[model samples]
Target: MAEAAALSRPAGVVGRRTWANGLFVLPFFLTFLALMVLPLGVGMWLSFQDYDMLGGYGGSVGFENFTRLWEDKIFLRSVLNTVYFVCLSTPAFVALGLFLAISLNDTYRRSAVLRSIFFGSSVLSVTIVTLIWRLVYMPERGLLAVSAGAVGLSSPSFMTTESLAMPGIAIVTVWWIIGLPMMLFLAALQQIPREVYEAAALDNASRWTTLTRITLPSIRRTIVLVAVIEVILQFQIFGQVHLITNGGPNNATRPIVMFIYEAGFRDWSLGYAAAASQVLFVLMLAASFFQIWIGRSKQED
Candidate 1:
């Protein structure tokens, strides 16, 4: 009886621990289901329905909404513009973040003040960021204009120029988001064993070799993570453009998210907006998987 009690005690403890773990996770699971899963499911359903602001669900439209997207010149342009922004912004996000992380990861340079300065902008609201940058981009009187005047150059209105508008927004976004990747890389850099660098130094490994071989390889997964996150984020860019250019100067700066917002709220075409949203979801999903595959392939190589 004593042996049986001892055996049963372990099983009872395991059961209680399992229940405790489930209880701990229950809140997050419920929140996710309520917030993420339900919205996504509803969006998918709405994509198939002929929904609107006034009439609500006006019955199913089948694939007409999705199929019509191909014929949408504005939608196609928005998609292209979004891709352009992603291409413009992602490299800077990854490279600049890595550069800043590597530069500041050292013992002597790991200054809290400096990190905070770089990271400070990211915590600001998008509206604030746009407002601040609006002053910087304001023609003939703003910081850039003043500086350009000082240099005997003219600073044209960036927000009005089709060629420069998206780039201007991209620059602002980079300033806002670069800090996160830097922090992520910094954390990953710290995780690398000190002994590895010490051995590299002892073996007469040059700085370039140390970075290319040891530093990057050690943080490859973090690199992929930062890249993927930036790609997904930049692809969905809307707030900056909405506040800055309002997708003006020939729709050169409009993005897919902005299109969805306008289509749903502005035009009251909720079904069409939901279809566009799903397309975006699929694009983001595909891009993430492709990046993960590429990262894994390189890691394997």
Candidate 2:
């Protein structure tokens, strides 16, 4: 009777454990299906059909939207503009973040304050950020113009100028995002053991040599991670350009996301918009893979 009781207890415990694990995982699986899988599947299906809200779904056109996208000049321009923004902003984000992290890694009282100041901007919503910068870039009356006037110089119209508009937006993006990478780098820096630095000091290593040999090599993985993340995020840039420029000054700052919005909601071309979104998704996936390949190669070397 005692042996039978012990066997029965084990079966009951296993049944309870299974149910507990399933309960914990069920919410995540449901959320993922609702949010990600369902939307993606719907979008892909819509892309092949002539989907119009007023007229309802037309018969499948078989890549007609994609072909049209190839010939659409404005859409092509938006893609180029997105690439340009990514190119302009990514390096600045990575370099400045790394610089700040290295400079502020000390335990000094002022370092903590400085770190907070740099990172505080990131916590603000994109709407708040754009509004603040809008006032800063306002012509003649904005803070930037007023400051320039005080110094006997004229302020450039940031949003109105075609040549400077995208780059100007890039600057704002870099400022907003630099904090994330900076904190990541700081964490990576802290993970480096103190004994390694002590050994370098004992060997009479110069500051530059120590940095080049010890510090950088130790954080190589973090650098690659930051670079890839920055690239992916910058490629989707829309909020700043949307709020500040509205793709103005002759659509000079229009990125792919804005184009997608225009096609879908404004123009009522859901099929075409879906196609454009797929293109952007493919581009991002390719870029991510390329970065991962480079990271793996470096690690192997």
Candidate 3:
């Protein structure tokens, strides 16, 4: 009888402990299920339905949304614009950030000030960044124009010209985002062993040779990590495009996110916008997987 009682006591204790642990994690798990999993599931369902007040949810149309999107000229244009922006902004930001990080990593004095200046870009809200750059890119009333006039040159309308608008947006994006990678790269640079450089110099390696052979190889992992992050972030660019261009100048600067917003909110086509969002999600997932594969391939080599 005593043996059975002892076993029961332990079993009850174990059950209680398990419940206690579950109680601690239950809130977070429930929150994730509600906020992320549930929304994603509903969004996926809505993507296929064609939900609109006029057209209404015409039920599951079997990939009609996907097909319709492919046939959409504006959608296609937006995708291309997004691709261009990502291609331009990601590389520029990553390269410039790495260069700045490498330069500042060795500086002893004023390093804090330089670091702050670079990092300060990331702290600015999207509205502030967009407003600031809008003024700079303005035709006659802007800094660029004023500078051109000072130099006895005619001012060009950067934002109004389709040729210059996308690039101008990209420049602002690069300036704002370079800060993140710069700080990350700076951290990575600090972790590199100083002895490695000294040894390279002892072997009579020139600065250029040392940089190419030593510094670069040592920082390859950091570069790859930052590059992947930059690519992902650039692909989803919305704020700058919306605030500055509103995807204007003949849809030249329209990105996928802005397109989705316009479709859902502006046009009141929630289902179509949801479809566009799913496409964007898939594209981003594929790009992320590709980056991971490249990183792994580099490691194997």
What C-alpha lDDT do the candidate models reach, one value each? 0.92, 0.91, 0.86
What's the lDDT of the predicted structure labeled candidate 3? 0.86
Candidate 1 structure, TM-score to reference: 0.92
| C-alpha RMSD of candidate 3 | 4.1
lDDT leader = 1
Best by TM-score: 1
lDDT of 3 by residue, 1-301 (tens): 9878767786778799889999989999999999999999998998988788566667777688889899999999999998888788877877898889888986677877898888988999999999999898888879999999999998777688888888899899888867899988888888889999889889999989988888777888887888788778888899998889888899999999998998898888888888999998888788778877887797788
Which parts of model 2 are misplaced by more than 4 Å? 1-23
Cα deviation at 123, candidate 3, in Å, is 0.9
**Which of 2 and 3 is ahead in TM-score?**
2
TM-score of candidate 3 against the unseen true structure: 0.89
Where model 3 places Cα greater than 4 Å from the true spot, the runs are: 1-25, 53-56
CA lDDT of 201 in candidate 2?
Answer: 97
